[model samples]
Target: MGEGVTVSGDIAASSDIRIDMWSKLGSRVEVGGNAYLGEFVTIDGKLLVEGDLDVGKEVKIRGGFEAKGWIVVRNPVPVIIFLFLYIREMMRLGKGEEIEKAVEELFEDSEDSQDFEGKEPSENIMIIPAGAKISPEVIEVAGEADIGSNCLLIGNIRAQTVETGKNLTLKGSVYSEGKIIIGESSTVHGNLFSKGQVHIGRNSRIFGGIKADSVLMHENARVDGTIKAPSGVSFLREAAEKQILVEVNALGKGIVSKARELPKGVLQDDLIKAPDVAEIVSLIKSSAKAKNGFVPGRKRKTARTQALERTRRFTGARTYRKEKSGD
Candidate 1:
């Protein structure tokens, strides 16, 4: 799904589900395999994941969540970098031809796909603009969120990182899993909290207390309630606060605009490390996970269930899946 798209009901995917930024799901989400959620995505109801779950920052799954596999939250690497790493690894394993074939499958049209020659993916996609309000309710994001100067907002803000532009007005609390920067001359009616650090800007006023790992405030800033910072609190001059704000603004813009993919390639004379022959042999001998009628999420006792299996031709191994009920 694209950004700003809102789904009113539950979504059940047989395989993976990839959501773009700022999408909202009103109900439960059940993924049969892995799920990759973009920044600021919200699932209003329960989320069940069978395989791994990788999510960007500022994501909110308000109701609850259950993962049969791993739950990792981080920004994903770019497609180009991923492809490069994959090709390199396959080459080391003497399987370069397999990667080439996969690339061909993606770019080349086949006779089986001729009927879909002219169709666009618009029918299967939705796009929501960033910074657009689709609902009157509070917005929760999984990535860093920035509120511009002189803006007024209601309800609490939840994000991985947060920055409020100068002269902003907000009625709700700001919660950040990372750092938070409250802009100059802004007013917040609610508390400000962060897991990392907080910097309150010049002439800003906060009605509620502030809690964070560390706190930095301008000398002119005022907080009506108590301040709690385990690391300590420090005050900066107005110019210093302004400098910090400028730097933070620049960094935030860079992170959003740049393609900063992770796991950078380590080059030693433009050569990667070669795989060990022993390691490859060991990998081939490793046992595979047993396949059963296991599926992610709660199984429906009301529905009839059947186990379907097929034996592998060469290895004599079997694969199994749960048959749909009443089919």
Candidate 2:
């Protein structure tokens, strides 16, 4: 017989149930053997099976249950399931309960589920919800990405390009081969490794180091670690070297103007007279040394004698006769 189909009741399929579209078993979906579903299938309620559930494409299970056999879901289903468990864990934490032990078991189950099933992931971008902890894997984003708040990822995100918005945080490293534009109010805890230009907006905080070909930091952005870029580094603030150069240019202009204001002929005359004044002072010093400090006293006496001789030459005997007549 053909594969069995059930809508609102229990499905007791001895062999297999091949579904092309949605199969909604309202209460409990029980299969004695195996179950196969095609693309765009939805099993709304609980699914209990003695065998495996092989979904060739997307499958949504609104209510959780067990599958005895290997559960296989293609590309986007795995991504969706990952998002669901992530949100559930966060809700548990918000209720003010101890979630450490429960979270550890959840992680182990997620790892086991991922290991057992393999899916061909789509090239489209995947958004991870808050409070989700993903294991280490290389997720390629061919399109734009938005990671919700409180998400924790252990693996690196490689993208053609990436833009992170506000309140979003990334735990592991981000490697963008293309341009990376981080929006304002976002925070990244791990290292950001990029080959292309990285633009960080205002109020964003990056705790780890950043490696990129070019980097642009907007006003008010804070980067705690070092940044290594080979092309060039640009800062919003004025550089010290440029300020020094401006000061030096102003000083040079001042010096040039002062030099131009002085008379060239006066400067030349002073240069020429300096040597003569130096020679005269040197000669006087030498003569004083030779006379054993008596040259200054002898020179003063000679100057006085010369002044008396000049006075005699000018007034002569007439001054002497006038002095005798008491006139």
Structural similarity to truth (TM-score) of each candidate: 0.37, 0.34
| Ten residues in sequence with the least summed lDDT for candidate 1 | 239-248
Q: What is the alpha-carbon lDDT of model 2 when measured against the actual structure?
A: 0.60
Best by lDDT: 1
**Model 1: per-residue lDDT, tens digit, 1-327?**
657767665678876678878888888899988898998899999999999999998999999899888889885558668888888999999997899898997678463344322554333222333443323455576676766666877778877898877888988898889999999999999999899999999999999999999999999999999999999999996432111111123223311224423335633334322233121122222223424444345343432332222223323332223233324
97-127 per-residue lDDT for model 2 (tens digits)? 4455655655574432342224422221233
Q: After superposition, how far is residue 304 of candidate 2 from its true place, in Å?
A: 55
Clashing residue pairs found in predicted model 2? none
CA lDDT, candidate 1, residue 193: 87
Candidate 1 has an lDDT of 0.73
lDDT (CA) per prediction: 0.73, 0.60
